[model samples]
Target: MKKIKTPISDEEISELQIGDKILLSGVMYTGRDAALPQLVELIKKGKTPINTNGIAIMHTAVSDAGIAPTTSNKEEIESTIPFLSENGVKIHIGKGMLNDETKKALNKNNSIFVITPPVAALLTNNVLEKECVAFENEGIEALYKLKVENIPGIVAIAHGKSI
Candidate 1:
């Protein structure tokens, strides 16, 4: 398995291939249906809370229950992927297949999609720290920033290729 650290570099993204297993460490963001579009709007307005460059965003919600992969193909989530990728989000972590346009967008922007296991225990064990970075009124669905180590995932899409 490849061990990757964030913010991942362009060279690292280029080297990844679909189906490659990876252990990701360092910082990552989390968002789901309610928060991602708000983040995109924040970026467009030049008021983003976090620097998105070369960062990884996981499609999940954090709560006392734990964390797990959410369906990334949801309209609210998928619609923001291209824009986020263009704005320098190097990796997107989630579950489910994405559309062709999203695949093309990721390739064009040198970004990739990774899918983690849906098991919450596995994911929560890897999280070292977390904070609500935006949309806190959304509660657990709010955007969060997490510091993690060795979070496991597989490259589901890279360079216009999917597995």
Candidate 2:
């Protein structure tokens, strides 16, 4: 039972490949579908109200009846991810698979998408604990530091490859 941190550096992420297990020991912020548009809009205007680079993981999630399950998620991570990645932000944590576009973006931008094991929710329950997690507007929240592996990605296809 080990806790993984987030908000790693490019060098650290570089040490890791498409599929490698490693621990992330850092703070993360939770925000998802309903919240992404605002973030993107802000970034479009060159106004990032919140500095995402501080937190290790920018979780696209929400809380419900005392439970946090990631709802509808998207890979259109521009404003935030692209700008954040350009600004040195580390990881983009989300549930399910990222579109080929995001995978390409992350790979091109030098970031990694650490997937959480969907089958084992309670199994990693210990990850949520008295870790003293904090964020703007959301205040104090419990987070599970998951050390996960990644999958292969391709942003563009070659001459013979079809989308």
Candidate 3:
């Protein structure tokens, strides 16, 4: 397994390969489909709450109940992935296969996409803390900020390449 600390560098990302085991530590932002577009708009307006550069974006909105990787196949949100990449998102964590558009975006942007196993309870154990950061009215679909440790995943696609 490869252990990676966040604010991940290009060299670090380049070293990853499809199916490689990963244990990621540090901070990752959370957002589901509802908050994704808002985040993109925030970036466009130059008013984003946090710098996305070298950071991972996990697909999930949270509540006290905890989190599990959300479906990555949401057509509305998946289409905007490349835009997120252009704005500095480096890692995307979710479940399921990505569409062609998202694949192309990942390729063009040097980002890595990971697929977490469908073990919500196990996944939640990795999260040290989480808080709603934006779009609270969206409820579970609100944006969240999470501090995670030893979060396990597999590289489904890495730096424009995939298994």
Model 2 lDDT, residue 97, Cα: 52
The digit string of per-residue lDDT tens for model 1 on 10-78 reads: 999999999999999999999999999999999999999999999999999999888998999999999
TM-score of 2: 0.59
Task: Estimate TM-scores for all models.
Answer: 0.99, 0.59, 0.94
Model 2 clash pairs are 4-24, 5-24, 5-25, 5-26, 6-56, 7-56
Strongest candidate by TM-score: 1
lDDT against the true structure, per candidate, is 0.97, 0.45, 0.84
Off by over 4 Å in 1: none
Task: State each model's C-alpha RMSD to the native.
Answer: 0.5, 6.8, 1.2
The lDDT leader among the candidates is 1
Q: Which candidate, 1 or 2, would have the higher lDDT against the true structure?
A: 1
State how far residue 90 of model 2 sits from its true place (Å): 1.7
